[model samples]
Target chain A: MVIAAIAIARIHDLFAVVMLTGIFSLLGAAAYVVMDAVDVAFTEAAVGAGASTVLMLGTLALTTSKERPAPAKNVISALIVVVFTGVVLIYGTLDMPIYGDPMAPIHHHVADHYLGKSSAEVGLPNVVTSVLASYRSYDTLGETFVIFTAAAGVLAILGQSRLPRRHHDQEDSEKGMVSSPEKSKGAST
Target chain B: MEQFPGLIPYWVIMVLMMMGLYIVIAHGNLIKKIVGLNVFQVSVFLLYITMAKVEGGTAPILAEGIKLYSNPLPHVLILTAIVVGVATTALGLALVVRIHNAYGTIEDEEIDKLEDQT
Candidate 1:
């Protein structure tokens, strides 16, 4: 996994990054397998490692791969924030339960209800799916909205483009392509 | 055979994860940062998968006399996460490519500069 990730990080080539990302996803899927969640692992392996990486690579084909030089002014501030975050995470570790301890509050809590009763209540062998799709349908809808929001955010950030104004004659000649006010009026007639 | 309890694997995973995170944080290049992020994610994936193993759990399938089955649920969840991760990575890369086309640089700093100029 480390090897795959490093392959992704150090490479200047966008195609290589996409490939490494796919590998990283595959590794994640494998990890999920070990976690005893077979269906989730399968979905992750197929969708995350396969389709998404390919889509990204296709997108990369339409763009450039070179990076710009970093400005020096904000370096110190960035470093400070990163260092502080790292320190906080390290401090947080002191309070974390040991890996896979059955007695951990996380494991002992509400997870049991989902694992034990979700199948009976939701009538689905895959409790996670049942909970996500049924018991928590509203949450799932909200999640979809969140995804839509992300798409909107990206579009809002990068989608504005300048289009050259067209003369009446030019617009008329390319009748099928560009719809002008005159054409709309004609169509209405 | 120094069996230091919970030391080796944890340190090993952490080191890899930190290195990956460092690359993503330090690199200004879009491609490089993605790579670093991939590395960081992979290390965590390994840790989670490794945690799933029990001392003598058998493969999670039922055969004639197989007494134990390793948990299958984790595998399923990981699979889905992997799929989602792939999709996100793909979309991100696609955006990077588009950004490169629009801004003429794959480096984050350069892209920012171009945007600022506009």
Candidate 2:
């Protein structure tokens, strides 16, 4: 997974990068399966690896798939920032519970009830389903709303008419849409 | 090694997260940035699932005579997040297409230069 992410960062071809991300997500899902998170693994594989890749490819169809090399100056600054943040996060992880420690605090919370009493309260074999559909069903409802908003946002943004038929459709309109007042100052004025 | 048992997952996750961060920060392409965002989000989802693991646990689905199941809460949360993640990704790509339409270029430098002129 880490290797795929590194490849993604280093590769300049957007198409290849998108494919690697799908592979990386698949690797992540495999890891989840190993960790006993079958439900999450299923969802990650289906959505992260499957749907998102298709969406990215569709975007690539509309846009350039080759990344222009960045100017060389900001490289060092970005590396420095990333390294510093990573160090702080690793330090934070030092005190975390050992991996897969059954006695970890995370297991003792409402997770305990959803596991222990869920059979009686919700009467389902799958605690994840019961919790998702019943216990924290409102959160799921909110998530559905969020998805609805996203779909609406996509339609609102892309569905409008008078789409850019050509570069110079409306000279005044183009000038009006100019966001920067610096370079195009003479033209817009 | 004795002091830290199973801390390896964090190391892997952190490395992946940093790579994602670097891609988003260092690269200027909008589609590439979206891909970077997905990588970062996946690393986080991995973190949650890793935490949900038990020393010797099975999936959260109850089975006959099975007393050990990994925590189900993270699974439920991540299930919602994955779907939402895809929805928002599609929305983001739609926005990118719009940006491409408006500017005829998706590179930030070009977009900025175009914006600066007008």
Candidate 3:
């Protein structure tokens, strides 16, 4: 399902693709919830589906929707990636736990404590939250920094020193809207 | 046979998740992708709520006559998530309108050309 969605994202139009990205995040959130990690699901739904989509659309509005046609040579790289991923997954499955078996090592080990005694140990009812905010607090903090770094990177790459003037103003009024001071700086002074 | 109810909910959640993902990826319209994303997020909310439910659970709130409460934590978390999702969608749509104004077209490819020139 993830692979199909990824493919569609690239093949479809920009608007459709953005919507699909939201769907992808939502599905991922649901997958986390079904796996009994409610906190992760909540974060995924909010950050992935909500905030990220909004940010992407905002950027999209500033740019065009249509993607450049793929260079023929890029197809080779894509093929190599697909084959490598498939092989890795097939090999990984050899060591995976069978679907939802209660006796699997995953179900029997240290996780059992969080399920059985988290409320008493941490004085919190939500085991997932306890782990995220307490046990693995540093990891969560690291993730926040990672997100911050990404935002900084985007700003560095795409930040405009000055806003673009709207040519649409002239299209609407038909009188040819006079350029503002900023525009005069760039054009006929 | 009793376990059937437990299993069907999981399957339905998975199906919905997949469908939402497909729309997000396959569709080209900006608005359509947002809708697809909404559907995807809703499915996850449903899955979490389902897991929190016990066989014969009721509301988590305490009352003199009430007992057998199902988990309320998941529901509370989902409510907050929903609000965030809506806010994100609104922001995205607003950006699209702005983009349409700056560039003559909403198509993604045309935007690239304009970007290339500058």
Candidate 4:
């Protein structure tokens, strides 16, 4: 995954970068599986690798595929900021419980209760599903609305009205390769 | 060295997160920035899932003989976050397309130059 990220940063071709991003997501999903996070792995594969790649390709179709070289000053400043933040984060992690420790604070209270009672209370085999669909249904509903709003926003921005209209003169200048404006107008309508 | 071994995953997480942040801050391309944002977000997802893991635990599906289960709460939370992340990515891409159509270029410095001229 780290190697893929490095390649993505160095590659200027937008298409290859998008492909590498998909590979990175897939690698992350595999790592999730190794950590026993099946549900997260599933979503990461489906949403991260699948949907995100398609969206990025659509954007690539409309935009230039080569990245302009960043200013050297910007790169230096960004490196400074990232290194500072990473050091602080590593410092903070020094106090965290060791990885996979059952006695970790997060596993003690609500997680234990869910593991103990979810089968009886929710009567479902998958405790993740019950917690998502039953115990925390309101949060899920909010998430659904967020998705709806995002879709609506995209549609509003990329709607038919926003699409560039092919004019008759523009078509004539292009050796009539494009269909007549009347035909395009008819098809659009 | 023993303490260091336990902290390996966290160090990996920090490196991955910083890589994403560096890309987002240094790159001028709009789509590249979005891709960087996705990488950053996925690292955060990994951090949550890593914390939710239990040693020698299986998936949180209730089974006849399974005694240990990983925490389901973080999985559920991250699931919603993943969906939200994709939705936001879609919206961001759509905005990028619009920006390209309007400005004739998607580079941040060029866009700033254009704005200054106007």
In terms of lDDT, which candidate is strongest?
A: 4
- Runs in model 1 lying further than 4 Å from the true structure: A66-91, A151-189, B1-4, B7-17, B34-98, B112-118
Residue A168 deviation, candidate 4, in Å? 15
**Candidate 2 docking classification:** medium
Model 4: DockQ vs. true structure? 0.58
Q: What lDDT tens digits, residue by residue, belong to model 1 across residues B1-118?
A: 2334433455556656676766667778776666566666656665555454443544344344654334344443443334334434443554564455455567766656666875
Per-residue lDDT of model 1, residues A1-189, tens digit only: 767655654565666667777777787677656655465566657665665555555445444444443345444554565566556654545454444544545443555566556656877655556656676667556545544444443343334222232222333223312222222222111
Cα lDDT of model 3 by residue, B1-118, tens digit: 4334335555555655655655555444555556567666766777656655544434343344653434444554564455445544444444454455566555555567788988
Q: In order, what lDDT does every prediction score?
A: 0.53, 0.81, 0.52, 0.83
Clashing pairs in 2: A180-B115, A183-B116, A183-B117, A184-B117, A184-B118
Candidate order by DockQ, decreasing, is 4, 2, 1, 3
Q: For residues A62-98, what per-residue lDDT tens digits would candidate 3 score against the true structure?
A: 5456654444454455445545644554444445333
Give every collision pair in model 4: none
Off by over 4 Å in 4: A160-189
